[model samples]
Target: MTDAAIAPRRPWAYAIFLVVFGAAGWWAAFQLTLDKFLVLEKGKNAVLNCNISPFVQCGTNLQSWQGSAFGFPNPILGLGGFAAVIAVGVTLLAGARLARWYWWLFNLGVAGALVFTIWLIVQSAFVLGTLCPWCGLVYLVMFPLFWVVTLRNAATGEFGSRLTRIGGILLPYAAPIAIVCLIAVGLIFQLRLDVLHHLAA
Candidate 1:
């Protein structure tokens, strides 16, 4: 066999990405949680640091019914979920080989998070007509994270042999894909919210 074929499949890069982005997500979520507490302790009239402008802020989102979709603050979910992601990344970095079942579960969780983030993005731009800075930071990390983990799983043949080939081909493009996705979101927000108009005003 060729040397390339004999080499073990180790996704060290993806592990590092997971750790870095996961921590970023955690921090963003933590900030949102703190802001949520501030809203509660001081009431809705309280001023928040994240309230950059009328068009971009967190207080409105925090007070919205959507923020407590599961009968609790959504950032509370991020606090736990991102912590798990960090732990999994640390384990992988330690050279522990995870089972296919575990990979599937992780992929599902990450996929769900991506979907939820997308929904939040849409709601923020359209329904709420405002952007939450801390929540935007969560999206910044989540998009790339979902791509990296899913592509890495496919590259490892966790999905199947066909996807394995495609995954390897696509792995290097994950960052670009994530950038495209973010750009798309930005376009949507700009069209709906007229963000630049607000900025120039």
Candidate 2:
């Protein structure tokens, strides 16, 4: 079975990355859940701390149907999902070399999250015409988390040799790509909703 206990490449770094990002994501989700409760307890007219401004607040998003896309608060999903992420990271840190199948599943989970996050970004910026700070925090970490997980799997040959080489080549660029995507989202919000103008108002 070889030395499965020792992950081959940059295991510590990846583990730490996952732990940090997962914790951040969980915190954002936790905040959103609290805000959701406040809205529920006090009614829609409630003013949450997350309700920074009309154009940049969690109230609209929290009250929207999209926030309960799965017939429940979406933050609940994050609470569970990010918890799994943290567990995986902790497992890795504990010197467990996960199987290829596990990595594949992890990749799938993160990719699904990234897709969902993108949809929320579009919905928030264009349709809802508001921004949720807590949701933004979730969105912020998701990009890099997905990118790193996918590339790491590829680099480790969980995909194949071709992707392994490509993943290795592209790994260093993951953070940059995520940053660019975030910037693009910010620009979209600014152009479509006049975020700056609203915040300044």
Summed backbone clashes in each candidate are 0, 0
Backbone clashes (count) for model 2:
0
Clashing pairs in 2: none
C-alpha lDDT (0 to 100) for residue 53 of candidate 1: 82
Instruction: Please give each candidate's TM-score.
Output: 0.93, 0.94
lDDT of each: 0.90, 0.90
User: Model 2: residues >4 Å from true position, as ranges?
Assistant: 1-10
lDDT of 1 by residue, 19-63 (tens): 889999999999999999999999778789999789878899999
Scored by lDDT, the top model is 2
* Candidate 2 positional error at 84, Å: 1.0
Q: Would you list the clashing residue pairs of candidate 1? A: none
